[model samples]
Target: MTMTSAMPDGRAERASTKSFYLIAWRWHFYAGLYVAPFLLVLALTGLMMLWTSVLSGRDGEKYYTVTPAQTQVAVSAQADAALAAIPNGKVVQYIAPRTEEGAAIFRVNNGDASSMVAVDPYNGTVLGSWDRRNGLYDLANKIHGTLMIGDLGDRLIEVAAGFGIVLIVTGLYLWWPREGKGFGSVLVPQFAARGRQLWKSLHVTVGFYISLILMIFLVSGLSWAGIWGDKFTQAWSTFPAAKWDNVPLSDATHASMNHGGVKEVPWTLEQTSMPMSGSDAGKMGIAEGQPVNLDGIVAFARSIGFNNRFQLGFPADDSGVWTLSRDTMSNDSANPLSDRTVHIDQYTGKVLADVGFSDYGVPGKAMAVGIAFHEGDMGVWNIVLVTVFCLSIIFMSVSGMVMWWKRRPAGASRLMAPAVPGDMKLWKTGAIIMLAVSLLFPLTGAVLLTVIALDYLIVRRVKPLKRALS
Candidate 1:
């Protein structure tokens, strides 16, 4: 039960331990002070993101075909019913419908152009037109996203994420044991061990193992809120322009395409080919503005190879075109248009741009794959990886906060580590390690350093705190 000194030279050990804390604890104190609020917000928001995902989970609505009355009613008729349901002055942003099921959704402007409402296509029933931010779930989302304070909240989150990355990295460095120790000691918690070392062991050992996953979450999340993420997304998405074979659209159907803006026609009909964005004629030429036979168009798509297709995203502008992207579920590719995209004319129904998975560019393919990885779309195998990453984020958020909280002092704490007698080598050594570890968390260190510089002028040089910590 007696402690034995392993150090052969006591003096040497004493020397190393002496100023350790003065350097370390002080560093830990200020770093935490600077970014605690930010860290806290990130944790809170992250927790919400986690819990909310489950609450919001719903199977994509299962579709059932309406009776003959419903099927006989065209989109135009449903559009009329919806018109009467909505308060006048509002405009439709988009009308989405399933021909087979006869269910339609109109994303509408709720008088005020800035906000929108979701309307039922079947009966023109108004689900609700509410501000997304003001709703309970949305409020949580905004708070999690921007802290509800707007730009300041956004910047704080970014800064916090930046610091979080730093914390994970430095926590790893601080966690490194002095060489010779092997896996079991490092990995398994020594339950009987008391104080800081026990907790640090739990935090670092577990935290480091999960860091890569945490980093992915952090980076992916940042993409949702920043320009860098958009750039990353764009870089990864397929820009079909370059790889596509650009043919002239001169002979392409001179039929009125969309409501107003021009759109490219699907280049090829078969599974092997994709529509290339053609020349100015294909881009601009369109003659008749006659209303195309809606039923015929639908039948044509079915005949060409787009069976069991997901909802089509009809293009809006001149550069826009109708595309039939497939549903990932059911592995349905029977329709030639089934596993791919078919961009056709609005009036003549001529193919403008037809692209399938085969022609997707590297970036496009990478994006598809990366997103699948990010979202756990691959398989049960990938779900394991995705689950690990999500759980890691939950842990990192928790541990980082706990470490910060555990280190903080009892009251209206200042941004400085409390000092103990440097004369005791053990205390000094512990303090220094704390300081170094805290410092390693770049944000904490920077904040502490700034506080140290300021503390001299205020607490010591100016007045009050001299009585407190001293």
Candidate 2:
């Protein structure tokens, strides 16, 4: 009797395990089908932007590098030169040179278009000019973020990224060894296997190796998405405007300063209310009677620890404040910990609000660091590491498609998706998982539910549709 009981229990356990594997595989297959194309575009565009940034500097700013000189011209002179280059233009922001030999950059707005003017800091000579949004880096970034189609593209990318998280979870579950296979079989691709088996091995191993990094990429990338990141996560993670200490606020937020599709401010401050100028509510900043001009603001920026590379934003109007900022995402500094933004009263030159990395909330801090890593801004090592990781992503995507193709029967009219086990009885667990995913990622959860509903209500009842789907 004892021997018979043990035999039945072992068989039951094996059956349950197989059922779960089939469930995981089915979900993984569907998620991969939807996410692979998006992943390919994201990885390729990411690589293009990365190399462009590393080689030519952010937004092609390296095109204006200059030789160092003993004496330097005034900040006002540089702004004047930039404004002169673009007639009828107004200087919106000034970017200090990163190195002694680097040229200063000025953002000038003429009508609806924006231009970047590179100037020699030594003699205030106008080096050259380029459209801010027309550069290769900006163009690639446009596609990378929104696919260059605006809000609709943003929503699609957001959904893809949301589903990508699901893909990672299911892929990991599928990769977990259950056959008592040795570690080598899981980590190393089986060279002896041929055709579909070899491709499967490569896909599994590559997926396993890049899983962690891919997760980081997905979460960080999602934090920039429109619905989830901007509306949900970022809304709560941003630095509180209440911390500005009773300063009057403008209608605009710090994000308003981010012009021409370029991110000029740190993520944590993007949604925070911009403090209006002309108030006596700020602490003493520029010395009494100092002219609140470009030169004065630049000096004040240096006095408060902003050095080498930082942005000095002009007041938008009578109510706007001068913004001094530096962050890794903007290529202002390599250290995310050094991220800082200060708003100064335009008339009084008083510091209105000073926000640093330490002031950011938990989510804000994580995103700040995550974005630095995501953008490969830490150093040369970061760039190399990210490049390899991107290549791995591309390989995994291609390998997955190749495996699907090989597994597909010749002249098959159906998609050949993984079949769900008929004996599976894990609805309760699946429901809970879906609930958790819905709460965490609304867009992805909705897509999963829609697919489930369609499969049950339409595909299951229609013979042709069921055959095509399964």
Who wins the TM-score comparison? 2
- Residues 181-264, candidate 2: write the lDDT tens digits: 866887999999999999899888988998998989998998878888889888878888999999998888888877756777
What's model 2's overall lDDT?
A: 0.86
lDDT of 2 at 126: 92
lDDT, residue 105, model 1 = 40
TM-score of each candidate? 0.56, 0.96
Q: Compose the digit string of candidate 1's lDDT tens values, residues 62-173.
A: 2223332442345445445544555563333332333444334433344444233433444544444433223344555577667878767765666565555555554554
Pick the lDDT winner.
2
Runs in model 2 lying further than 4 Å from the true structure: 1-7
